[model samples]
Target: MHAGSWHNRYPGESRIVLDLTSLISLYDTALAPSLVLVCAGLERCDHRVLGISSEDISRLMRKLTEVVSRPDWVGSGIDQKTLIHVIVDRYVDRLELMQHLLNFTSSDSQELLQRAKLAQAQLRVMLTPYLLHSTVVPSSDTSGVDAPHWASLMFKNCATMHTSVMINQILLMTSSEHL
Candidate 1:
């Protein structure tokens, strides 16, 4: 149910767990940092009811994983190979965190997993710049280009092509990674 609808049904309910996918999908960066905090908090809740095994933690981990799609990747002016490395490193970190979370036997395993997932999400975002700079990219001076577009466009020769090849390799590895 929607928040208003849910409120209508249980105005004085003691517990309410939200599914934030729809809201986060509409995000501008302005909301991301705050939403990440809210989502992180809700993810730490204990929402068991009527004897059902709570899946909030599992649900949250999956949603946070999905919520990481940043449109900034499309035209951030970073070379493509650099983008590829960043994405792969991010995914690898995600996988490692997920793996660690999967091994827990704590009484609060779900909460722990939720926390770990959030940590990973934040880490991935923070590490993006480092990943982009991980490769030693050759710099091409745009001394002649007067326009910003032309100047920005000149990072397209070796830096761009190499990035494309690197990105393709990362995609191939990611695809076959599950096989």
Candidate 2:
């Protein structure tokens, strides 16, 4: 029920959700998740975009669809798919979505462009091998892999705090050896 706080807190202020969860989950990725925290930080900032590439947008949509569909029951993480569905239905700002292609000259446009580029490059880096190898599980341990770096990927705010906590529970779950 506490869903509308950000709107009143930042009245008349435009908002954007960087959606880096889709970007971060694009591969088995082996990396521990850090992108969520970083993106959440960025989304809290005021910003705008000038031109977001279609390829990048397409990548997000694809990653969104894929991750949204494949809930990782084996690991400790949120039902990424469910959270994404909820966020898409409720919080997404259409004006921000529509103006994604503005021409960049100011700070806003540059930040948008930067976010897009980061996602685009991230997809290429993380997914290329997966596609080439045609498997979900990677060949080896990737514990040292760094999480993606971006802004605006938080799926839980005060309203969905419980869901966020559950997700962390899932991620921290592991083999009996860790216990």
Candidate 3:
């Protein structure tokens, strides 16, 4: 089933069982990577450097968090713990990258810095529940799978993407300085 179709199904209705693998693949290949790329490209410049407005990115980010936090994934055979872990891990990486950028940002970039800070604060508020709850009752479908290992791998990929973006940005800065 297409990922868009999942949104059309009503909650608590009898529907085809969604495969957890497809769901994870959709997130891994699409959602998480897009979010990471956008977050990585966010800069302290006056112009919209990524060709997308901050409001649009903010809306997408909010929708992503909302969808993943819903219990619907549980009924669809997804282990909520693992799903949340993957998303939260990516979010933490994004937050860290934003903080790293903010620390080096100049005073002239106050607007961008404030926006990044706000986004970080909002994400933290949204993640509070997942962070506070420590109980893990493994689902039968995912019991054998190692969620932490998966999360670690996902985090590493995001980190790698962020690193590449940062390196490119640095190179651009240096090259432009010489021009």
Candidate 4:
């Protein structure tokens, strides 16, 4: 599928119609996995093989930012703590995909990497409130969900992924210096 088509299909202001299952399905079936495959193919073959362009990457990033920024999951009548798992999973996949593109793509590599970093930072800012809320000790009125434990696990996963990406970036820079 063309990246432009994916961008066009993204939910807009009417995204309130999207339930959690639908949103998760969209991410699993169309968005992140497709991008990962594209990145993998780009690594193995030329862009022509997958019909992807630098422009496609930029547009996809914008669409992804829009998707992530919108709070479609807010009113979905599910436990917010459970949704954090999905959110973390999505962001981690996005970060890993960005790392692959940063390391593998030859065209506009630095520009795309900068864009990815900015996006990742923005996501972290967005997630901070939720993380803080989750880690707080719950009162008797709240469900006994052990939110702090889940939040800690999710935070650790995100930190580990970030550290790996940074290590990869440093290695790439050092190896390029030798070349």
Local accuracy of candidate 1 as per-residue lDDT tens digits, 36-70 = 43444243343222222235444545666665653
Tell me which residue pairs clash in candidate 2. Answer: 39-151, 39-152, 50-102, 50-109, 76-170, 76-171
Q: Compare candidates 1 and 2 on TM-score and give the better one.
A: 1
Rank candidates by lDDT, best first. Answer: 4, 3, 1, 2
Instruction: Give the total clashing residue pairs for model 4.
Output: 0
Q: lDDT, candidate 4, residue 62?
A: 72
State each model's CA lDDT, in order.
0.51, 0.46, 0.55, 0.56
Count of clashes in candidate 3 = 0
Local accuracy of candidate 2 as per-residue lDDT tens digits, 7-68: 54422243543333545542222332333333443543432222434555566677657777
Candidate 4 per-residue lDDT, tens place, 82-110, comes to: 34544565478766765664554446768
Q: What TM-score does each of the candidates earn?
A: 0.22, 0.21, 0.27, 0.22
**Candidate 3 pairs with clashing backbones:** none
User: Candidate 1 or 3, higher lDDT?
Assistant: 3
For model 2, the stretches where C-alpha displacement exceeds 4 angstroms are 1-45, 71-179
The 10-residue segment of model 3 with minimum total lDDT is: 22-31
